[model samples]
Target: MTDPELPKLVLPGEYLGAAEQFLPGRGTYEDGGRIYASLLGVPAIDPADRTVRVEPRNAVPEVREGDLVYARVDELKTAMAVCTVLSTVASRRQVPGAPEGTVHISKAKDGYTESLAGEFAIGDVLVARVLQAHPGIKLTTAPASLGVVAARCQVCHALLTLGEKEAVCPRCGHREHRKFAKGPLPSPSGAHGPGGV
Candidate 1:
Protein backbone atom coordinates (compact mmCIF):
# COMPACT_ATOMS: atom_id res chain seq x y z
CA MET A 1 0.00 0.00 0.00
CA THR A 2 3.16 2.21 -0.06
CA ASP A 3 2.63 3.57 3.49
CA PRO A 4 0.28 6.61 3.78
CA GLU A 5 3.15 9.13 4.06
CA LEU A 6 5.39 8.29 1.10
CA PRO A 7 4.40 11.46 -0.83
CA LYS A 8 0.98 10.40 -2.12
CA LEU A 9 0.53 12.56 -5.30
CA VAL A 10 2.70 14.80 -7.45
CA LEU A 11 2.57 18.32 -8.89
CA PRO A 12 0.35 19.69 -11.67
CA GLY A 13 3.05 20.74 -14.13
CA GLU A 14 4.81 17.43 -13.61
CA TYR A 15 1.99 15.13 -14.68
CA LEU A 16 1.86 13.52 -18.16
CA GLY A 17 -0.99 10.96 -17.94
CA ALA A 18 -0.23 7.41 -16.94
CA ALA A 19 -1.33 4.56 -14.69
CA GLU A 20 -2.07 5.75 -11.15
CA GLN A 21 -0.69 9.28 -10.51
CA PHE A 22 2.02 10.70 -12.80
CA LEU A 23 2.54 14.26 -11.56
CA PRO A 24 6.09 15.05 -10.57
CA GLY A 25 6.92 16.53 -7.20
CA ARG A 26 6.38 20.30 -6.80
CA GLY A 27 4.56 20.59 -10.16
CA THR A 28 1.23 21.84 -8.72
CA TYR A 29 -1.99 20.38 -10.10
CA GLU A 30 -5.70 19.96 -9.50
CA ASP A 31 -7.28 17.05 -7.70
CA GLY A 32 -10.73 15.44 -7.84
CA GLY A 33 -10.05 12.24 -5.88
CA ARG A 34 -9.97 10.23 -9.11
CA ILE A 35 -8.12 12.80 -11.19
CA TYR A 36 -6.12 15.93 -10.40
CA ALA A 37 -5.68 19.04 -12.56
CA SER A 38 -4.69 22.65 -12.54
CA LEU A 39 -7.04 25.42 -11.58
CA LEU A 40 -6.72 29.14 -12.26
CA GLY A 41 -3.15 28.82 -13.62
CA VAL A 42 -2.16 27.09 -10.40
CA PRO A 43 -2.31 23.44 -9.51
CA ALA A 44 -5.03 22.14 -7.24
CA ILE A 45 -3.33 20.79 -4.21
CA ASP A 46 -5.01 20.12 -0.91
CA PRO A 47 -1.52 20.53 0.51
CA ALA A 48 -3.21 18.44 3.18
CA ASP A 49 -4.77 15.39 1.50
CA ARG A 50 -1.51 14.81 -0.35
CA THR A 51 -2.92 14.10 -3.82
CA VAL A 52 -1.70 14.30 -7.42
CA ARG A 53 -3.40 16.51 -10.06
CA VAL A 54 -2.52 18.31 -13.30
CA GLU A 55 -4.10 19.54 -16.50
CA PRO A 56 -3.08 20.64 -19.98
CA ARG A 57 -1.35 23.98 -19.65
CA ASN A 58 -2.92 26.77 -21.67
CA ALA A 59 -0.38 28.55 -23.90
CA VAL A 60 -2.34 31.78 -24.28
CA PRO A 61 -2.27 34.80 -21.99
CA GLU A 62 -5.23 35.55 -19.71
CA VAL A 63 -6.91 38.51 -21.46
CA ARG A 64 -10.65 38.90 -20.99
CA GLU A 65 -12.62 41.17 -23.28
CA GLY A 66 -13.73 44.03 -21.05
CA ASP A 67 -11.75 42.56 -18.13
CA LEU A 68 -10.16 45.08 -15.79
CA VAL A 69 -6.36 45.04 -15.84
CA TYR A 70 -3.86 46.67 -13.49
CA ALA A 71 -1.37 48.60 -15.57
CA ARG A 72 1.82 50.67 -15.08
CA VAL A 73 1.93 54.08 -16.74
CA ASP A 74 5.08 54.68 -18.77
CA GLU A 75 4.43 57.78 -20.89
CA LEU A 76 1.65 60.34 -21.08
CA LYS A 77 0.53 62.63 -23.91
CA THR A 78 -1.66 65.71 -24.17
CA ALA A 79 -4.83 63.60 -24.14
CA MET A 80 -3.57 60.03 -24.05
CA ALA A 81 -0.67 58.19 -22.50
CA VAL A 82 1.40 55.16 -23.46
CA CYS A 83 1.58 52.48 -20.77
CA THR A 84 2.82 48.99 -20.02
CA VAL A 85 0.62 46.13 -18.83
CA LEU A 86 1.35 45.06 -15.27
CA SER A 87 -1.23 42.46 -14.25
CA THR A 88 -4.41 40.98 -15.65
CA VAL A 89 -6.14 39.99 -12.45
CA ALA A 90 -5.88 41.57 -9.01
CA SER A 91 -3.75 39.48 -6.70
CA ARG A 92 -1.04 39.90 -4.10
CA ARG A 93 1.49 39.32 -6.89
CA GLN A 94 1.30 39.67 -10.70
CA VAL A 95 1.94 37.25 -13.49
CA PRO A 96 5.26 37.32 -15.33
CA GLY A 97 5.45 38.09 -19.12
CA ALA A 98 1.74 38.88 -19.56
CA PRO A 99 2.64 41.27 -22.43
CA GLU A 100 2.52 45.06 -22.30
CA GLY A 101 -0.85 46.77 -22.95
CA THR A 102 -2.25 50.34 -23.08
CA VAL A 103 -5.08 52.51 -21.74
CA HIS A 104 -6.43 55.54 -23.60
CA ILE A 105 -7.70 58.56 -21.67
CA SER A 106 -11.10 58.42 -23.38
CA LYS A 107 -11.43 54.80 -22.28
CA ALA A 108 -10.18 55.71 -18.84
CA LYS A 109 -13.67 56.34 -17.67
CA ASP A 110 -17.18 57.27 -18.80
CA GLY A 111 -17.19 60.78 -17.33
CA TYR A 112 -14.72 63.61 -17.91
CA THR A 113 -11.66 61.80 -16.53
CA GLU A 114 -9.75 65.08 -16.29
CA SER A 115 -5.99 65.00 -17.01
CA LEU A 116 -4.11 61.74 -17.18
CA ALA A 117 -2.30 62.77 -14.00
CA GLY A 118 -5.62 62.90 -12.17
CA GLU A 119 -6.43 59.35 -13.24
CA PHE A 120 -3.04 57.62 -13.56
CA ALA A 121 0.65 58.21 -13.08
CA ILE A 122 4.03 56.76 -13.93
CA GLY A 123 4.27 53.27 -12.42
CA ASP A 124 0.66 53.62 -11.33
CA VAL A 125 -1.54 50.53 -11.22
CA LEU A 126 -4.76 50.99 -13.22
CA VAL A 127 -7.73 48.77 -14.02
CA ALA A 128 -8.63 49.06 -17.69
CA ARG A 129 -10.38 47.14 -20.48
CA VAL A 130 -9.53 45.98 -23.99
CA LEU A 131 -11.27 48.25 -26.51
CA GLN A 132 -9.61 47.32 -29.81
CA ALA A 133 -7.11 44.76 -31.05
CA HIS A 134 -6.89 45.65 -34.71
CA PRO A 135 -3.93 47.88 -35.68
CA GLY A 136 -2.79 47.20 -32.13
CA ILE A 137 -4.90 46.88 -28.99
CA LYS A 138 -6.73 49.91 -27.64
CA LEU A 139 -7.58 50.06 -23.90
CA THR A 140 -10.31 51.81 -21.88
CA THR A 141 -11.75 51.86 -18.35
CA ALA A 142 -15.23 53.30 -18.12
CA PRO A 143 -16.71 50.76 -15.75
CA ALA A 144 -17.28 51.27 -12.08
CA SER A 145 -16.00 47.85 -10.97
CA LEU A 146 -13.19 47.91 -13.53
CA GLY A 147 -10.85 50.56 -12.22
CA VAL A 148 -7.95 50.84 -9.83
CA VAL A 149 -7.56 48.22 -7.14
CA ALA A 150 -4.75 49.79 -5.09
CA ALA A 151 -2.85 53.07 -5.34
CA ARG A 152 0.20 54.13 -3.30
CA CYS A 153 1.02 57.58 -2.03
CA GLN A 154 3.84 59.44 -3.77
CA VAL A 155 5.36 60.40 -0.45
CA CYS A 156 4.50 57.57 1.94
CA HIS A 157 3.68 53.92 1.14
CA ALA A 158 0.12 54.36 2.33
CA LEU A 159 -2.94 53.24 0.31
CA LEU A 160 -4.82 55.82 -1.72
CA THR A 161 -8.24 56.23 -3.27
CA LEU A 162 -9.96 58.27 -5.96
CA GLY A 163 -11.29 61.45 -4.42
CA GLU A 164 -12.75 64.02 -6.79
CA LYS A 165 -10.08 64.04 -9.52
CA GLU A 166 -7.11 62.61 -7.65
CA ALA A 167 -5.88 59.84 -5.35
CA VAL A 168 -5.94 60.64 -1.65
CA CYS A 169 -4.19 58.47 0.87
CA PRO A 170 -6.43 57.45 3.73
CA ARG A 171 -3.59 56.57 6.05
CA CYS A 172 -1.55 59.80 6.16
CA GLY A 173 -3.94 61.91 4.08
CA HIS A 174 -1.17 62.02 1.53
CA ARG A 175 -2.78 62.80 -1.81
CA GLU A 176 -0.98 61.00 -4.64
CA HIS A 177 -1.86 60.49 -8.26
CA ARG A 178 -2.37 56.75 -8.73
CA LYS A 179 -4.94 54.20 -9.86
CA PHE A 180 -6.69 51.82 -7.49
CA ALA A 181 -9.74 49.60 -7.13
CA LYS A 182 -11.73 47.86 -4.43
CA GLY A 183 -10.47 44.42 -5.41
CA PRO A 184 -8.81 42.54 -8.24
CA LEU A 185 -9.13 44.52 -11.50
CA PRO A 186 -10.21 43.24 -14.91
CA SER A 187 -8.08 42.13 -17.85
CA PRO A 188 -7.02 44.73 -20.44
CA SER A 189 -8.36 42.73 -23.35
CA GLY A 190 -11.68 41.76 -24.93
CA ALA A 191 -10.78 38.16 -25.45
CA HIS A 192 -11.95 36.01 -22.56
CA GLY A 193 -11.63 32.28 -22.99
CA PRO A 194 -9.26 29.31 -22.80
CA GLY A 195 -6.80 30.82 -25.24
CA GLY A 196 -4.43 33.08 -23.28
CA VAL A 197 -5.74 32.41 -19.83
Candidate 2:
Protein backbone atom coordinates (compact mmCIF):
# COMPACT_ATOMS: atom_id res chain seq x y z
CA MET A 1 0.00 0.00 0.00
CA THR A 2 1.23 3.50 -0.81
CA ASP A 3 1.76 6.02 2.04
CA PRO A 4 -0.75 8.86 2.07
CA GLU A 5 0.40 12.40 1.45
CA LEU A 6 0.76 14.40 4.70
CA PRO A 7 1.13 18.05 5.43
CA LYS A 8 4.68 19.31 5.89
CA LEU A 9 3.53 21.63 8.66
CA VAL A 10 0.40 21.38 10.74
CA LEU A 11 -0.80 23.74 13.46
CA PRO A 12 -2.84 22.90 16.47
CA GLY A 13 -6.52 22.37 15.70
CA GLU A 14 -5.80 21.85 12.03
CA TYR A 15 -7.76 18.99 10.52
CA LEU A 16 -5.73 16.00 9.43
CA GLY A 17 -8.09 13.32 8.19
CA ALA A 18 -11.16 11.36 9.08
CA ALA A 19 -10.85 9.05 12.09
CA GLU A 20 -12.20 6.25 9.93
CA GLN A 21 -9.20 6.63 7.62
CA PHE A 22 -6.37 7.28 10.10
CA LEU A 23 -5.95 6.46 13.78
CA PRO A 24 -4.88 9.46 15.84
CA GLY A 25 -1.37 9.21 17.18
CA ARG A 26 1.11 11.52 18.92
CA GLY A 27 0.37 15.23 18.68
CA THR A 28 -3.05 14.45 17.29
CA TYR A 29 -6.53 13.99 18.65
CA GLU A 30 -9.74 12.54 17.27
CA ASP A 31 -13.13 14.10 17.73
CA GLY A 32 -16.33 14.08 15.73
CA GLY A 33 -14.88 11.42 13.47
CA ARG A 34 -12.04 13.77 12.51
CA ILE A 35 -8.35 13.81 13.37
CA TYR A 36 -6.76 17.13 14.33
CA ALA A 37 -3.26 18.15 15.08
CA SER A 38 -2.80 18.89 18.77
CA LEU A 39 0.52 20.68 18.35
CA LEU A 40 2.59 22.44 15.72
CA GLY A 41 4.42 19.71 13.91
CA VAL A 42 4.90 17.67 10.78
CA PRO A 43 2.24 15.13 10.07
CA ALA A 44 3.22 11.54 9.32
CA ILE A 45 0.99 8.92 7.75
CA ASP A 46 1.69 5.24 8.10
CA PRO A 47 -0.10 3.25 5.43
CA ALA A 48 0.40 -0.20 6.99
CA ASP A 49 -1.07 0.80 10.36
CA ARG A 50 -3.38 3.50 8.91
CA THR A 51 -2.22 5.83 11.67
CA VAL A 52 -1.60 9.56 11.48
CA ARG A 53 0.79 11.24 13.91
CA VAL A 54 2.30 14.65 14.21
CA GLU A 55 5.89 15.06 15.31
CA PRO A 56 6.41 18.25 17.25
CA ARG A 57 8.95 20.58 15.67
CA ASN A 58 10.14 21.80 19.03
CA ALA A 59 10.26 19.51 22.02
CA VAL A 60 9.63 20.87 25.46
CA PRO A 61 12.48 20.37 27.86
CA GLU A 62 12.07 18.03 30.78
CA VAL A 63 13.84 17.65 34.10
CA ARG A 64 16.33 14.80 34.30
CA GLU A 65 18.77 13.37 36.80
CA GLY A 66 21.95 15.45 37.28
CA ASP A 67 20.50 18.49 35.53
CA LEU A 68 20.99 21.80 37.30
CA VAL A 69 17.82 23.74 37.95
CA TYR A 70 16.61 26.96 39.50
CA ALA A 71 13.87 26.68 42.05
CA ARG A 72 12.03 28.70 44.64
CA VAL A 73 11.59 27.40 48.13
CA ASP A 74 7.90 26.79 48.65
CA GLU A 75 7.93 25.33 52.12
CA LEU A 76 10.37 24.11 54.67
CA LYS A 77 10.05 21.39 57.26
CA THR A 78 12.47 20.01 59.79
CA ALA A 79 13.53 17.24 57.45
CA MET A 80 12.95 18.64 53.96
CA ALA A 81 12.39 21.69 51.82
CA VAL A 82 9.76 21.82 49.10
CA CYS A 83 10.49 23.90 46.03
CA THR A 84 8.92 24.82 42.71
CA VAL A 85 11.41 24.27 39.92
CA LEU A 86 11.65 27.40 37.82
CA SER A 87 13.86 26.24 34.97
CA THR A 88 16.68 24.01 33.88
CA VAL A 89 20.11 25.64 33.80
CA ALA A 90 21.37 23.96 30.67
CA SER A 91 18.36 24.54 28.46
CA ARG A 92 17.01 27.46 30.48
CA ARG A 93 13.61 26.04 29.75
CA GLN A 94 10.71 25.52 32.13
CA VAL A 95 10.55 21.85 32.98
CA PRO A 96 7.41 20.10 31.75
CA GLY A 97 5.34 17.47 33.58
CA ALA A 98 6.72 17.87 37.13
CA PRO A 99 7.75 21.24 38.45
CA GLU A 100 7.88 20.50 42.16
CA GLY A 101 10.92 19.07 43.87
CA THR A 102 11.96 18.07 47.37
CA VAL A 103 15.32 18.50 49.01
CA HIS A 104 15.74 16.20 51.95
CA ILE A 105 17.78 17.56 54.84
CA SER A 106 20.41 14.98 54.05
CA LYS A 107 20.82 16.54 50.59
CA ALA A 108 20.75 20.10 51.89
CA LYS A 109 24.36 20.38 52.96
CA ASP A 110 27.59 18.56 53.49
CA GLY A 111 27.40 17.99 57.21
CA TYR A 112 24.63 16.84 59.43
CA THR A 113 21.63 19.11 59.07
CA GLU A 114 20.02 19.77 62.44
CA SER A 115 17.08 21.41 60.75
CA LEU A 116 16.06 22.75 57.35
CA ALA A 117 15.05 26.08 58.87
CA GLY A 118 18.57 27.50 58.77
CA GLU A 119 19.42 26.19 55.33
CA PHE A 120 16.29 27.13 53.44
CA ALA A 121 13.19 29.26 53.79
CA ILE A 122 10.04 29.98 51.88
CA GLY A 123 10.56 32.24 48.81
CA ASP A 124 14.27 31.60 48.70
CA VAL A 125 15.58 30.99 45.18
CA LEU A 126 18.10 28.22 44.83
CA VAL A 127 20.13 26.30 42.28
CA ALA A 128 19.94 22.58 42.70
CA ARG A 129 20.59 19.36 40.83
CA VAL A 130 17.91 16.87 39.95
CA LEU A 131 18.49 13.58 41.72
CA GLN A 132 15.35 11.84 40.59
CA ALA A 133 12.68 12.82 38.06
CA HIS A 134 10.26 9.93 38.03
CA PRO A 135 8.04 8.81 40.92
CA GLY A 136 8.86 12.34 42.13
CA ILE A 137 11.34 15.08 41.41
CA LYS A 138 13.96 14.79 44.12
CA LEU A 139 16.66 17.48 44.31
CA THR A 140 20.01 18.02 45.96
CA THR A 141 21.72 21.22 47.02
CA ALA A 142 24.62 19.54 48.71
CA PRO A 143 27.11 20.32 45.96
CA ALA A 144 29.25 23.43 46.23
CA SER A 145 27.59 24.77 43.10
CA LEU A 146 24.08 24.03 44.30
CA GLY A 147 22.20 26.06 46.91
CA VAL A 148 20.56 29.41 47.52
CA VAL A 149 21.24 31.98 44.82
CA ALA A 150 18.82 34.68 45.88
CA ALA A 151 16.72 35.34 48.93
CA ARG A 152 14.64 37.95 50.65
CA CYS A 153 14.67 39.33 54.12
CA GLN A 154 12.33 37.15 56.15
CA VAL A 155 11.29 40.18 58.16
CA CYS A 156 11.29 43.08 55.67
CA HIS A 157 10.92 41.25 52.35
CA ALA A 158 13.81 43.17 50.88
CA LEU A 159 16.15 41.49 48.46
CA LEU A 160 19.11 40.05 50.29
CA THR A 161 22.64 40.22 48.98
CA LEU A 162 25.44 37.78 49.34
CA GLY A 163 27.29 38.26 52.57
CA GLU A 164 29.99 36.54 54.54
CA LYS A 165 28.64 33.03 55.10
CA GLU A 166 25.04 34.27 54.78
CA ALA A 167 22.61 36.50 52.92
CA VAL A 168 22.19 39.96 54.32
CA CYS A 169 19.39 42.37 53.70
CA PRO A 170 20.90 45.79 53.17
CA ARG A 171 17.67 47.48 54.10
CA CYS A 172 17.05 45.57 57.30
CA GLY A 173 20.59 44.45 58.10
CA HIS A 174 19.17 41.04 58.79
CA ARG A 175 21.53 38.16 58.27
CA GLU A 176 19.97 34.84 57.37
CA HIS A 177 21.99 31.65 57.19
CA ARG A 178 21.71 29.51 54.08
CA LYS A 179 23.39 26.78 52.16
CA PHE A 180 24.77 29.11 49.50
CA ALA A 181 25.93 27.94 46.10
CA LYS A 182 29.54 28.70 45.29
CA GLY A 183 29.66 31.44 42.61
CA PRO A 184 27.85 34.46 41.31
CA LEU A 185 24.10 34.54 40.88
CA PRO A 186 22.49 33.03 37.82
CA SER A 187 22.00 35.68 35.16
CA PRO A 188 18.61 37.33 35.12
CA SER A 189 18.49 36.84 31.34
CA GLY A 190 18.13 33.11 31.90
CA ALA A 191 21.49 32.49 30.29
CA HIS A 192 23.60 29.88 32.03
CA GLY A 193 26.60 32.08 32.70
CA PRO A 194 29.80 31.42 34.56
CA GLY A 195 29.56 30.81 38.30
CA GLY A 196 27.24 28.49 40.14
CA VAL A 197 25.09 30.99 41.99
Candidate 3:
Protein backbone atom coordinates (compact mmCIF):
# COMPACT_ATOMS: atom_id res chain seq x y z
CA MET A 1 0.00 0.00 0.00
CA THR A 2 1.07 3.58 -0.57
CA ASP A 3 2.25 5.39 2.48
CA PRO A 4 -0.32 7.83 3.82
CA GLU A 5 2.29 10.49 4.57
CA LEU A 6 4.22 10.41 1.28
CA PRO A 7 3.31 12.72 -1.57
CA LYS A 8 0.65 11.58 -4.05
CA LEU A 9 2.93 12.36 -7.00
CA VAL A 10 6.70 12.58 -7.29
CA LEU A 11 9.10 13.71 -9.94
CA PRO A 12 12.34 12.10 -11.00
CA GLY A 13 15.18 12.70 -8.52
CA GLU A 14 12.75 13.44 -5.68
CA TYR A 15 13.91 12.03 -2.36
CA LEU A 16 11.77 9.25 -0.99
CA GLY A 17 13.43 7.97 2.18
CA ALA A 18 16.62 6.74 3.79
CA ALA A 19 17.95 3.37 2.61
CA GLU A 20 17.67 1.99 6.11
CA GLN A 21 13.96 2.77 6.30
CA PHE A 22 12.98 1.19 3.02
CA LEU A 23 14.48 -0.90 0.24
CA PRO A 24 14.46 0.62 -3.25
CA GLY A 25 12.15 -1.28 -5.59
CA ARG A 26 11.32 -0.66 -9.25
CA GLY A 27 11.45 2.94 -10.43
CA THR A 28 13.52 3.95 -7.40
CA TYR A 29 17.28 4.19 -6.86
CA GLU A 30 19.35 4.42 -3.75
CA ASP A 31 22.39 6.62 -3.48
CA GLY A 32 24.35 7.79 -0.45
CA GLY A 33 21.85 6.02 1.76
CA ARG A 34 18.92 7.95 0.31
CA ILE A 35 16.18 6.60 -1.93
CA TYR A 36 15.01 8.74 -4.84
CA ALA A 37 12.32 8.44 -7.49
CA SER A 38 13.68 7.46 -10.92
CA LEU A 39 10.53 8.35 -12.86
CA LEU A 40 7.79 10.98 -12.89
CA GLY A 41 4.97 9.12 -11.24
CA VAL A 42 2.91 8.34 -8.17
CA PRO A 43 5.02 7.04 -5.25
CA ALA A 44 3.92 3.92 -3.48
CA ILE A 45 5.25 1.81 -0.65
CA ASP A 46 4.90 -1.91 -0.14
CA PRO A 47 3.87 -2.17 3.48
CA ALA A 48 4.61 -5.88 3.47
CA ASP A 49 8.30 -5.40 2.70
CA ARG A 50 9.03 -1.70 3.31
CA THR A 51 9.94 -1.06 -0.30
CA VAL A 52 9.34 2.15 -2.22
CA ARG A 53 8.69 2.51 -5.95
CA VAL A 54 7.30 4.95 -8.47
CA GLU A 55 4.69 4.01 -11.07
CA PRO A 56 5.62 5.88 -14.27
CA ARG A 57 3.12 8.28 -15.78
CA ASN A 58 4.53 8.18 -19.31
CA ALA A 59 7.42 7.12 -21.49
CA VAL A 60 10.91 8.55 -21.02
CA PRO A 61 13.96 8.92 -23.23
CA GLU A 62 16.84 6.47 -23.06
CA VAL A 63 20.51 7.24 -23.09
CA ARG A 64 22.39 5.71 -25.99
CA GLU A 65 26.07 5.27 -26.72
CA GLY A 66 27.70 8.14 -28.65
CA ASP A 67 25.16 10.65 -27.34
CA LEU A 68 26.28 13.91 -25.79
CA VAL A 69 24.85 14.53 -22.36
CA TYR A 70 25.04 16.86 -19.38
CA ALA A 71 25.67 15.34 -16.02
CA ARG A 72 26.35 16.58 -12.51
CA VAL A 73 29.20 15.21 -10.43
CA ASP A 74 27.96 13.74 -7.18
CA GLU A 75 31.04 12.06 -5.76
CA LEU A 76 34.66 11.65 -6.66
CA LYS A 77 36.31 8.36 -5.86
CA THR A 78 39.95 7.44 -6.30
CA ALA A 79 39.69 6.04 -9.82
CA MET A 80 36.22 7.14 -10.93
CA ALA A 81 33.89 10.10 -10.82
CA VAL A 82 30.28 9.32 -9.98
CA CYS A 83 27.59 11.42 -11.62
CA THR A 84 23.87 11.65 -12.17
CA VAL A 85 22.93 11.98 -15.82
CA LEU A 86 20.79 15.09 -16.25
CA SER A 87 19.86 15.61 -19.90
CA THR A 88 20.57 14.74 -23.49
CA VAL A 89 22.26 17.60 -25.34
CA ALA A 90 20.33 16.94 -28.55
CA SER A 91 16.79 16.96 -27.20
CA ARG A 92 17.53 18.88 -23.97
CA ARG A 93 15.21 16.44 -22.25
CA GLN A 94 15.79 15.31 -18.68
CA VAL A 95 16.67 11.62 -18.48
CA PRO A 96 13.78 9.87 -16.74
CA GLY A 97 15.72 7.52 -14.50
CA ALA A 98 18.39 10.10 -13.71
CA PRO A 99 20.63 7.09 -14.02
CA GLU A 100 24.06 6.94 -12.48
CA GLY A 101 27.01 7.34 -14.81
CA THR A 102 30.73 7.01 -14.22
CA VAL A 103 33.85 8.41 -15.80
CA HIS A 104 36.94 6.31 -15.28
CA ILE A 105 40.17 8.18 -14.67
CA SER A 106 41.52 7.02 -17.99
CA LYS A 107 38.56 8.57 -19.82
CA ALA A 108 38.75 11.95 -18.08
CA LYS A 109 41.11 13.57 -20.54
CA ASP A 110 43.35 12.99 -23.51
CA GLY A 111 46.47 12.65 -21.37
CA TYR A 112 47.34 11.22 -18.03
CA THR A 113 45.33 12.39 -15.02
CA GLU A 114 47.14 12.16 -11.70
CA SER A 115 44.07 12.73 -9.62
CA LEU A 116 40.31 12.56 -10.19
CA ALA A 117 39.69 15.29 -7.57
CA GLY A 118 41.94 17.66 -9.50
CA GLU A 119 39.85 17.22 -12.66
CA PHE A 120 36.42 17.37 -11.02
CA ALA A 121 34.66 18.58 -7.90
CA ILE A 122 31.31 17.80 -6.42
CA GLY A 123 28.48 19.64 -8.22
CA ASP A 124 30.44 20.45 -11.35
CA VAL A 125 28.31 20.12 -14.48
CA LEU A 126 30.06 18.27 -17.26
CA VAL A 127 29.40 17.80 -20.95
CA ALA A 128 30.37 14.21 -21.62
CA ARG A 129 30.05 11.61 -24.35
CA VAL A 130 28.41 8.33 -23.58
CA LEU A 131 30.86 5.50 -24.14
CA GLN A 132 28.54 2.73 -23.00
CA ALA A 133 24.80 2.91 -22.35
CA HIS A 134 23.84 -0.51 -21.06
CA PRO A 135 24.85 -2.73 -18.14
CA GLY A 136 26.24 0.45 -16.64
CA ILE A 137 26.62 3.88 -18.15
CA LYS A 138 30.21 4.88 -18.90
CA LEU A 139 31.24 8.38 -19.96
CA THR A 140 34.22 10.18 -21.38
CA THR A 141 35.28 13.82 -21.53
CA ALA A 142 38.46 13.26 -23.51
CA PRO A 143 37.69 15.23 -26.62
CA ALA A 144 38.58 18.91 -26.86
CA SER A 145 34.91 19.83 -27.06
CA LEU A 146 33.76 17.77 -24.11
CA GLY A 147 34.46 18.33 -20.41
CA VAL A 148 33.36 20.56 -17.59
CA VAL A 149 31.14 23.30 -18.97
CA ALA A 150 29.97 24.77 -15.66
CA ALA A 151 31.56 24.78 -12.24
CA ARG A 152 31.43 26.77 -9.02
CA CYS A 153 34.36 28.06 -7.06
CA GLN A 154 35.31 25.60 -4.36
CA VAL A 155 36.02 28.43 -1.96
CA CYS A 156 33.09 30.77 -2.65
CA HIS A 157 30.43 28.69 -4.35
CA ALA A 158 30.11 31.39 -7.04
CA LEU A 159 30.05 30.49 -10.71
CA LEU A 160 33.51 30.25 -12.18
CA THR A 161 34.47 32.15 -15.28
CA LEU A 162 36.56 30.76 -18.09
CA GLY A 163 40.19 31.76 -17.88
CA GLU A 164 43.11 31.12 -20.16
CA LYS A 165 44.66 28.68 -17.70
CA GLU A 166 41.89 27.88 -15.25
CA ALA A 167 38.42 28.69 -13.94
CA VAL A 168 38.32 31.94 -11.97
CA CYS A 169 35.80 33.12 -9.44
CA PRO A 170 34.92 36.80 -9.77
CA ARG A 171 33.69 37.05 -6.20
CA CYS A 172 36.60 35.43 -4.38
CA GLY A 173 39.35 35.76 -6.94
CA HIS A 174 39.93 32.03 -6.61
CA ARG A 175 41.34 30.04 -9.50
CA GLU A 176 41.05 26.32 -10.10
CA HIS A 177 41.82 23.84 -12.84
CA ARG A 178 39.28 21.97 -14.95
CA LYS A 179 39.18 20.12 -18.24
CA PHE A 180 37.04 22.75 -19.99
CA ALA A 181 34.96 22.49 -23.11
CA LYS A 182 36.18 24.24 -26.23
CA GLY A 183 34.47 27.12 -28.07
CA PRO A 184 31.91 29.43 -26.39
CA LEU A 185 31.31 29.33 -22.69
CA PRO A 186 27.78 28.81 -21.47
CA SER A 187 25.87 31.71 -19.94
CA PRO A 188 24.20 31.64 -16.54
CA SER A 189 21.03 30.26 -18.13
CA GLY A 190 23.04 27.71 -20.17
CA ALA A 191 21.72 29.19 -23.45
CA HIS A 192 24.91 30.42 -25.08
CA GLY A 193 26.98 27.36 -25.89
CA PRO A 194 26.53 24.75 -28.59
CA GLY A 195 23.53 22.51 -27.93
CA GLY A 196 22.96 24.26 -24.63
CA VAL A 197 19.69 24.96 -22.88
**Top model number, TM-score:** 2
Residue range 1-197, candidate 1, lDDT tens digits: 22343234334334323325443323443344233333323434335544434333444455545555566667777687676666555442454564567666776766776787776666566666666544455676566555555567777877666654467677888766443444433343434643222
Assess the local accuracy of residue 87 in candidate 1 as a C-alpha lDDT between 0 and 100.
56
Every model: Cα RMSD to truth: 9.3, 9.1, 13.0
Task: Provide the lDDT at 104 for model 2.
Answer: 94
Which model scores highest in lDDT?
Answer: 3
Which lDDT value does model 1 have at 110? 67
Q: Least accurate stretch of 10 residues (summed lDDT) in model 1? A: 33-42
- Of candidate 3, the 10-residue stretch with the lowest lDDT total is 184-193
Q: Rank the candidates by lDDT, best first.
A: 3, 2, 1
Go through the candidates in order and give each one's C-alpha lDDT.
Answer: 0.54, 0.82, 0.86
Over the stretch 1-197, how does candidate 3's per-residue lDDT look in tens digits?
67886899898999999999999999999999999999899899998899999998765668887778899999999999999999988778899889999999999988899998888899999988888889999998876677898999999999999765498899999999988888643332233345532
Q: What TM-score number comes out for model 1?
A: 0.52
Q: Look at candidate 3 and tell me the lDDT of residue 55.
A: 91
* lDDT string, candidate 2, 1-197, tens digits: 22347668889999999998899988899999999999998899877788889888886778877677889999998788999988988788887754789999999988899989988889998898777878789988886667988888989999899765788889989888988888653343322345422
Pairs in clash, predicted candidate 2: 184-197, 185-197, 186-197
